[model samples]
Target: MKERFLRAGAAVLTAAALGAGLSACAPLVIGGGAMVGTLMAIDRRTAGTQVEDEGIELRAASRIRETLGDRAHINVTSYNRQVLLTGEVATAEDGQKAEQIVRGVENVLSVVNDLGIMPPSSLTQRSNDTFITGKVRASLVDAKDLTASAFKVVTERNVVYLMGRVTQREAKRSAEIARGVNGVRKVVRAFEVISEEELQRQLAQPAPVTQDPAAASAPARR
Candidate 1:
């Protein structure tokens, strides 16, 4: 069990490191070295689902802009089709409108609104939040027993929001990892938890023959 987790963790780091360094410049191929596109084979979501999430985010953002204009400063993050709405709006009504618009998007499983009903965050605050998010992500990558790619970290106002499809152990472990990172005031889990056995079944499944370049490039596009 330990060996399996370690192998998975190593794969996560390798893909992430190579992707950051070379994805802009080259592609990684496997199994007889055939050109198979970018190193986009590490995510838990399906290719179609990823594309759908992208569409959902874009449409929701557009709708918010059309409806509220500059009255709201919003961040839309979708994982496994679940939309997480953060940032601030000028009024409670605007916040509600933001969620309503996103919920209307196709393929959105649910909407988690953490939108503040106050003034928008300043650019300095947003920059600090981005830095905190990077710290948490790096801590997850340093964790030896968890698949960091299985988790998505988002931060707002010093709070860390975790999103993903994960097993119970992974959920608990990941939250702890995020908490240990400095400047993360609180950890909020928006994960879809699964059983350990289900995770093992997924790990044992064979890779699909066809690689969707669109799916492969999802992270890059983000």
Candidate 2:
């Protein structure tokens, strides 16, 4: 009973955190402290690559905004230097343009442009998507067989996009969990599939240590 209560509390807190970020339309920082530290420890990408992914997302989003302006409502998510482009574009040409701009960004290993050619989603729709994303993440957290932090969850409209460097088993399991979340219209994967051996090696490595206590306490960007 106590365990269930704790899980419920975690879900609520996580949901609230995620909702705040989504409503603000900002890049998400999943959580702080031990939870995030654990996630960072198990993440497949090197520390440098994780930082690079953040840079790629910021630069790509900026360029897209400058070039496409209000014509696109694009969400940029990068994992292991690969980018996933979601949200709506005014036209098919605008979608292509957005992809081109991201590809031109430095150190972008690849791009998956999943931009829909449609009008921007309503605020209500975005809020609902945020709720779905939060629920999916909380569900993953509650699953004993998975590490929730390994997956990056982003929802647009009613679709949930999952990005990670995961083995096929982890990818399949994560997708199933996300699909079962309420209000999720679709589940999309932009995963970098790694072998089980590689995953085992990652798990075997010690968590990174930092001299800066603040940095050490913060969640490592995936």
Top-scoring candidate (lDDT): 2
Per-prediction TM-score to the true structure, in the order listed: 0.78, 0.83
Tens digits of per-residue lDDT, candidate 1, 1-222, equal 534543454455445534532332122223212222122245577656666777787788788889998787788888888999988898888888888888888888899999988887776676677667767766776788877667777788889999998988899999998888888899999999989888888878764445555565667643
**Candidate 2: stretches off by over 4 Å:** 1-39, 211-222
Candidate 2: C-alpha lDDT: 0.81
Residue 25 in model 2: shift from native, Å? 2.8
For each candidate, how many residue pairs have backbone atoms clashing (under 3 Å)?
Answer: 0, 0
lDDT of 2 at 92: 95
lDDT of model 1, residue 1: 58
